[model samples]
Target: MDKQAALHHFKEHHFTPLLESELDKLEAKFHRCQAGLISDFKQSFRDLCAYILSMQQQGLKEPIGYIHYSFLRTQMLEQSYLYMVEAYSAEWYEDDSDCKLTYDASWAYAPMSAMLENLEQQRKIYMGAINSADVERLILESAPFFHSFVDSLVRLAIAESVQSPEYQAIHKAERLLIRTGEYRDISENLYVWDQEPLRADEVFEQLMQSSEEEPYVYENLKSLSLPHLHQFQKDLRYNDFSYSDLRGSQFHTCILLGTRWQQANVEGGSFQGCLLSDTDFRYCHLKGVNFSEASGRVDRENGLRTPGLCGIRFEHANLDEADFTNVHSFEHAYFEGASMQGTRVPRIYQQHWKLSDSQRESIVWTE
Candidate 1:
């Protein structure tokens, strides 16, 4: 469905009604306990706990559900702190000569404290999953949920007191909404690298034209399909090309120090005679790539050598005919694929230092 239709469906059917109901119940309880009496406060705390538990059970089934639930829980916990602060007033704490007397303090503080801690922990868990998740997937699947979540918060904040602790919760909710909105924007206009609006040759020319002291660095080029890029041999150090498609590209004798190629598609790319020290190739498709004579280790001015293959990963790629001879730390590189047939590889001793069984079997020994 379209964005508006999907958002309307989610808001009307799932996110809006649920959040409004929970917030309404919490607000009603807060209003009833305005006098700050311990009994009334305890009841409100119990109500909050019930809502939290209910959301945990029902609103964490999917990625969108978890994101919505986290946003709401954080807001709820922030509001709950208002009751705790009110409970800790002079009436609750009595200072005697020998000790301080506490009255119904645990009833007002304990549950909310526990719930806040749980809320933070759950938020972390959800955020970790969200970070690892595909941005496009999240935008397509969770955008409606995020939209309704932010809308619910905005509606709730209409009558909320700014000086009150509940306002802090609203502020936090707004920050989260803004972050999600930014993600949505990115998803809406994700660059099509295959379109080649930003060509490697053009970029190289631009870099050559610039007089910056540091080597040119490009970042956030995810999902760019820049195929068949040739003549990339330049000072392209410290560049981030993660999650881009560079299929069948050529990088003959390139200096790729500290470059990040994580999750990039470098299928059939050539990197022959390249300087690849400190380059990250984790989760990349390096099928048939030429790395022969590539210097994975570099001599530094501090009389020490940079690690040769500290973080190279070829976990699940077609390595047929990919050259690895004279590539330092070939032994340290991960190669968890099928056995090499006619591929040129480092010697058995060079491959033995840290090679796994599958990696050992995957290499064809050359002298």
Candidate 2:
């Protein structure tokens, strides 16, 4: 087509609105991609934290565990980019539209790859300077640098002045959406430190304060882990984890005498070999929570029974050899998969228990 003929067609079809509309669509898609990238990155970080916690639980602490993690953030960010923006970039460029315009929208995201690479290099440099054997500290300190990635990843690959005012405005809004509380600032929540992390005592105080403000502190108690606390310390005894979300939290083998876990979501957590004497776990969610070898207020040898687990509902909970000797009213507590061999209960509500033959065989009910 001749230039004159093409110009005429463009003017006749009112191509200006069509172009603007397509640009708006591109902007909207960018936001979706941007949000997805942040989401994926955050989820991956959480999984990493969970994995590290699991290792710590096994009494495995190695210095330079930091070396392994130093390589993750940048790789994870690149993966996020591929999923969020790169996959659709080429598709959008080749799109057949009424305006017959071909847009390499991906060009606006090209600078991000270089930026991520630079970040990785810089991270390696920072990681090298650390002389400490503390793996947690190494990981924690390296984390704040990546917080900027959440803000910078969504920036346009083009020069700001070259962009149209509308494109700039759209980009601004998308960036602001994440910077605001809705997406959550990583430093404020995930890293949760200014220069250094809070001490165990400080974390406890912070959690207790947060508990009072919120109805139930759901899933935000990730910082409550106390690796430094020893079994002999008993420092966190009588801690108030009641009415909080403790799903998947680990308190295995800790001395938690008289701690209140009432109504807390303690599902999938471990209390193996824990001293849970007089702990108020009434109505708490204990599904999949490991209580193997846990002891309560009752000590049949010492005659220290104090009506433990009175009115407690352990329906369907497998108490594998959990010492409930003389626990008052726990005769009514659920003991579905428990091997009650040698474990004694009142047997008062034994008739009301609904158990499979396997379950019944498992529970060696003693009066």
Candidate 3:
């Protein structure tokens, strides 16, 4: 097909429209997740406290003042109505704070997990049955908020006498709580609110970082929605950029090796002089982009090896003026549709290439 005909076909058949549609759905779910998640956490914390207090009433020392969700999955988190909790494990360890407790994926709650799953659907799962969302990193950054919430709740339970349903406020104006209303023993999860309501929007912002500033050193930027982001010579290697909407973003000489760009919209972006060895770009948009001097391959010398691109698929992508002279994988890279026009690849690729007649006609050999 001619260039115009092929481009028209690609535009009509591209799957980007489906991905963009999902963004709206995810945003709505995110708002729901924030408020509901916090409330559920408060209830879980209060339930744990009541369980400890019951043991103390029976002349047994409270094992631990922990709202440990992983442990509670066998107890209050077990879909109980009266805080009749049990234990997942008979052990507790020291938390990040002075509290003798443990921590798992705080986002392991049902609402937050659904939000994360839909956000990065193609993520690979290694540790568990489910694909782990940048959960570890999210928990790390929001450590202050979690620790404060835990410590304050523990202090309230320890100081106050667990006798009846009525809560005696130390400071009425500063106390923030959510009551279970099911049991008098399980009254509330207390915290010093400082007269401010929980900022749900602020919590959600951690996942969808804005383009105004650079990301953290180890931040997981998978399924990002920031567009027109501008940067220079950044080290963003070994990150997941799959399903990202980074269209028109500029990266002058950035290191993006082993980065995933599957189905990411990077149209009109600039990646001049970038190191993209072992980078996956199959099914990504690259319409009218500048990628000059980008090394997709490297030479191994004195037994020192460097990562190189092996197979790439420009699946109906617009590869306008992309020069792959030094790209060793240029021979193995697949190109179809509009990507066929004027793509400059090494002459060596043509001599030793194993592509059939139809595939060979799509490529242009260069010195």
- TM-score for each of the candidates: 0.41, 0.27, 0.37
RMSD of 1: 24.1
Q: Which TM-score value belongs to model 1?
A: 0.41
Candidate 2: Cα lDDT at 240: 47
Per-residue CA lDDT of model 3 for 1-367, tens digit only, reads 5544533343333222323333334333433463454455445545545544554456453333323222232222332212222221123232222222232323422332333344344323222322232433332222222222222223223212222232231212232232211222323332122234323344235423422245322223546676887766666664556567889988777777656566788888877777776565766787657776676664333211234312344555666555565553444355544454555656777765455565456556777
lDDT per residue (tens digit) for residues 1-367 in model 1? 5545544554455433443444344434433553354344334334433443343346421111111111222233233212111111112123121111111222222333333343334334333432212222322342232233222222122112222343222212111111112221331111112212355556545555533344455333445667876744566664657667888888777777656676788878888777776566756777778887777663422212233313354554556667777776444455554334456785765535455666666567886
- Model 3: clashing residue pairs? none
List ranges where model 3 is wrong by over 4 Å. Answer: 1-219, 297-306, 309-338, 346-348, 352-359
lDDT of 3: 0.44
Clashes of each: 2, 0, 0
RMSD of every prediction: 24.1, 24.9, 22.4
Model 2 TM: 0.27
lDDT of 2 by residue, 69-186 (tens): 1112333334332211110111222422211111121322343344334334443433344222222232333333232233233221111111334322221110111111111122
Candidate-wise lDDT, in order = 0.44, 0.37, 0.44
